[model samples]
Target: MKKLLKYSAFGLGGLVGLMLIVVAIVAATFNPNDYKQQIIDLVQAKKSRTLKLDGDIKLAFWPKIGANLGKVSLSEHKGSAEFAAVDSVKVSLALLPLLKKELIVDTVYVDGVRANIVKYKDGTTNFDDLLSKDEEESQTIKFDIDGVNVTNSAANYSDEGTGAKYSISKLNLKSGHVALAEPIDLETDFTVTANQPAVAANAKLKGNFLVDPATKHFVAKGLDASIKGDLLGGKDVDITASGDIDAKPDTKEFLINSLKLAATGQFSGAKLTIDLSAPELKALKDEVTSKEAKVSLVQEKGSDTFKANLVLADIKGSPKALQSSGITGDISGVQGKRTISGKFSSPFIGNLENLIFDLPKLAGNLDIKDPALPNGGVKGNFNLTLHADAKQELVDSKFDLKVDSTQLNGDVAVASFTKPNIKFNLNADTLDLNKLLGTSSAANPAEKTAANQKPADLSALKNLLLDGKIKIGNLIYQKYRLSGLNVGIKADGTKLALTGLNVKLDDSQIKGNLAISQFAKPLYTFDIDIDRLDVDRYVTANTGATPAATKTSDKPLDLSALKALNADGSLRIGSLKYGKTKASNIRIDLKADGQKLSLNPLAAKVDDSQINASIGISRFSDPIYSFNVNIDKLDADKYITKSDPNSKSPAAKSTGDTPIDLSALKKLNASGEAKIGWLKLANVKTENVSIGLKAADGIATVSPFSANLYQGNMS
Candidate 1:
């Protein structure tokens, strides 16, 4: 029995040796290059593409059954450009496993592989034919691979429709065992260039994956990726991301769990950093949801830090209908301990047939404090609520705000986005207009420079509409001080109106109403009343310039603004003091229409006398004026006396002939009539005086000039 066993073992050994010898003979004697033509012909017949083998094909039999090919290329069907090319490809297979119907590949090494892909304007790709197959040729093929390694590969893609080109170079990929149900490890590094944006990026990825080939299910864990690039022309960016992903093909569900990302970049010469983390994010065929997310951002140049928390409920809809989807979410943010919370909801999410976006509720509250404010800082809080009607129109909105010593409560409605109807009442204890103008020194240099620059456009204000009432207890505007100021204002496309305007200035009260229209030519109308006014003091206080006592030179007045003015107004002053004139119970009605202006009557009581006058001017280019005056009981002695009571008038002094400037008289044509009831100079008195005067073409004439003086008549 022992002898028989030994002989049998020897036979088995001989059989194994013979098989090895046969493999060796095949590896050495067989030339795979001999069948290259046949292989190329077969590929051309099947795929309708040209194949080229520039180098040689070789086989190996020692550790594994393998094949190596060199310098292989495949041509595009109708173009001279090669579709794919490779410098070398080495494939090895486990010989014994194939007999048992198990494909156990030892390793696959590919080097210097290059591909060029193109998309035509008609949405067809160069590889479209390669991806399509007949029904009979469509069959599932399965295989297992132990490992794969690729190096120095490149791919280029271009889209004619979008005019975008992309290139990938120095691509290296490594993978562990891949099977139908087992986990695999993968790592990749590549550099990508995009022509459309003209940017370049270097990226790396490492992860472990579990894939089910039959079901097309995939899950990835310990996934990490990083990219560094120059974006947006010249901004340097570095981004890192880590996450776990799970996907189900049958249900069309995808979930990302425990995702974290960080980014740092230089934008507009500022260093910016951002960090983000999310607990879970999920997307189904109909809905996308997120549990919680947190984000933090910092800017080095601005010294600003922001943090936010966000939560989203089930949100589902098509892209255009997303606004109507029944989405519920809340977002909160913090900046230096100041907090703001906003919540939003809609009622049309799941209803596919609804096209209207009915926003059922939107509410928010904000509290802010910033050190850059004019008064060191500003503290404020406000609440806002909005609701949309069934037709998806925003109808009723309410706002309540309290900032510093100011309080505003308002309700608003809108017919459309272009027009709004508002009812609001605003009250402020004190508001410094200068402060609100952002005249503080703490403003950024760049921002200040931008503010000082002239704006290129003012077209946005062409469609503005404002209607509101504002009141302030104490206000300081530039050089003016005002108290208990209230104004109701309305503005639309054609006109602006201000009513019920009352303000106290310089211990006096003023009330007025004004209207301005811009439909065609600019026009203005005003009605003003004043209890008392010190014109000189008020003017000096507001203008910061002292009035000159005497004219030093004669210069032409710029009446261009007045030439464009079209105004009609009335002024009533109880008492007015201007320069050396003191007047009481004054009333003036004035009108200006283009280049023509008229003062129908200017009446005032001075001391124990009353005076009335009327004036008119026309021909703006060469003004012509006419005036009429009436005086009752005027004391002429007071006007003739010197301003200094102690000093006497100097004796009459005569010099050489002084030429009169008749040039002014040539421009002016005047005609008037005057009447005086009484006039007295020292002891001489005259009454019942009437005069008529006319001057034109440098000529003066008087008619029916008569006066009763010293109980006698003179003409």
Candidate 2:
């Protein structure tokens, strides 16, 4: 047995040595480049395409069997233009594994690969011929690769039918140990460009993946991705994401663990930063659920800053319907030197089938601060229920809000986003305009300024569509305190109407209806009535003795606002009283347009005397005034102020010339006529009195001054 084993060993050694010598000889003498023409000819004959080999073909042996090809290109089918090209490629194989019919690759190195792919108008791809299925079954071989490296590769794709094009350039991909049903580490960097939406971006990806082709199962662990681009109107955007993912199509199960995303970008002229995180998310069949999700966003523009944070728990949903146990959020912002903040909580429900979203119990607290506010702005709490319908583009909400010492409840609805129509009904206990606006009601009404002369801007009212009703128990404005105030407002396009306006103040009941149109050049029409108004309650009362003379402004009035004023109104008062004068059944009809104004048919009854008068003004900048007055009877004592016997100023009790300055009257152009059935002067009585006066161009004239005095007349 020893002799037989020795002979077998010797023979095997000789055979191995001879084989090695033969391999060395072949490697030395054989030139793979010499057969390039033959290989090209064969490819052309079988695939009907031109193949070009511009560089040398090299081979290696000993440690591994490898082949390296340089500058290779393939042309389109039956065409001369190149379809795909490669600068160089090196492939290495395990020699021992090949002997057992097992393919084991060490590493693959590919560089400078470029390809253009196209889908024609007929939905046929450029590489359709290459993808044709083989008619006969092929043997399946098991293969493994230790690693793969690809660098400087690019691909372009275009769809002629859709007119869409996309390109990926500077692609570098590296992978480790790729095998069926085994984990593989991959890293890639690329730049992608698209024409349809006009976007360009650079991206990097790193991950470990396990894929099973037969079961269509996939798993990704430690996945990290980053992208930077000019994606928002050519503004810079950067995004980073990380997560672990598992998907099994056969079982319809998917899971994501520890998902985190962060983004920073310029959006709509504002710099925005966003962060999002999820602990665990799962999808089984049609049901999707998440343990908890959190999101935060911050925006900045100029001096304005806004920030919000939200947390959602127990999120469960399908594609068509979604629900959440609750949502908590906080919003804070600084705008116009003012700080505003709010904190809210609610349960959210969404139904995409009906395109509706609802917040059944939304509650919040708000705090606002501004230096201009009287009491440093307001702090409030509010409760609301809301419904939003996307299909109809409508939002409806009901709210109860309390701020300061006021309580307000309201229902608001808005529809049609493009041209909104709003409807609202509000009720409030009390509102103080002066306190809310940081203004004072004690400001003198006689004080005038150039700023106040500017025409009011009503452009915002041109396209408003609103119908609302407001009711308040008490309202305070200026020096007036109004109670039981109910106002109805309706507006459409350039027209606005205030109807059923009812209020009370200072022992008076007031009701009015007002309408305005052509807001840019407003035209107003109003009807107002007051049952009884004690004017003395609203006006400041004088104390002590009266002055002999009062100071008046010499500056010309700025009536430029009247150029846009157009109004027609009637005012009625059942009883009106001022100082010692009293009037009943007073009526005034007013009409004004452009620079002209008139109050005609001003009729009133004063202590059994019937008075009728009319006043007109024109050329508002340099005013012209005209008046006509008639009275059936007059008792001057009832309307005149009685002299104080204990006066301090000598001018107050003087009967001589008081040196009155008539300069203001000289500047005005005026004409008037007066007729009185009876007149009382210095405790003397006269009958059939008539007078006429005309003044213009710094001149004054008094003519036809006649009266029946003691059965005689004087002119």
Distance (Å) between predicted and true CA of 41, model 1?
A: 5.6
Off by over 4 Å in 2: 1-315, 331-342, 366-380, 403-405, 429-448, 451-454, 476-480, 541-561, 641-648, 653-661
Candidate 1 positional error at 197, Å: 5.2
Task: Write one digit per residue (lDDT tens) for candidate 1, span 1-715.
Answer: 9999999999999999999999888878989899999999998988788899988888877757888889999989766679999999999887877666777786799999999999999999998878756667644434689899999999999999999999999999999997768889999999989988787989999999888866788988998999899765546789898999998856657788998998888877667678887778666666656664666666554544444443334344442344333344444444443334444443433222232334444434444433434564445565555554433434566666655665566666664554554445566778765544433344544565322212123333335566778888888766678999999988776667789989998677999998776535556788899999888875543443432333333333234445666778889899988877788988888898777788878898977679899988776544567889898987877667344544453222322364544444443467888888897878689997888878766677777698899789888
Clash totals in order: 1, 0
Give the per-residue lDDT of model 2 (tens digit) for 1-715.
Answer: 9989999999999999998999898888999999999999999998888999999999987557999999999998899987899999999898887777778998899999999898999999878878758788766667799899999999999999989999999999999998878889999999988987677999999999988998898998999999899764546889999999998866657799998999998888899999999889887667878898999999999899999999988778873677999899999999776798999999988764556889999999989887766787888899999999988999999999887777899999999988889999999999876555554345555585444333456767876899999999987776778899999999998789999999998589999999988787678999999999888887777764554356566655555556666889999999998876788999999998877888898899987788999988888787778899999889887667666768966755766576766876657678998899998877878888888889887787877788888787767
Clashing pairs in 2: none
**TM-score, cand. 2 vs. native:** 0.56
Question: What's the true lDDT of residue 9 in model 2?
Answer: 97
Error of 1 at 258 (Å): 5.0
Q: What is the TM-score of each candidate against the true structure?
A: 0.47, 0.56
Model 1 regions more than 4 Å off: 1-28, 37-50, 61-65, 95-101, 196-199, 213-216, 231-234, 247-258, 278-293, 302-376, 383-437, 440-715
Root-mean-square deviation of candidate 2: 14.9
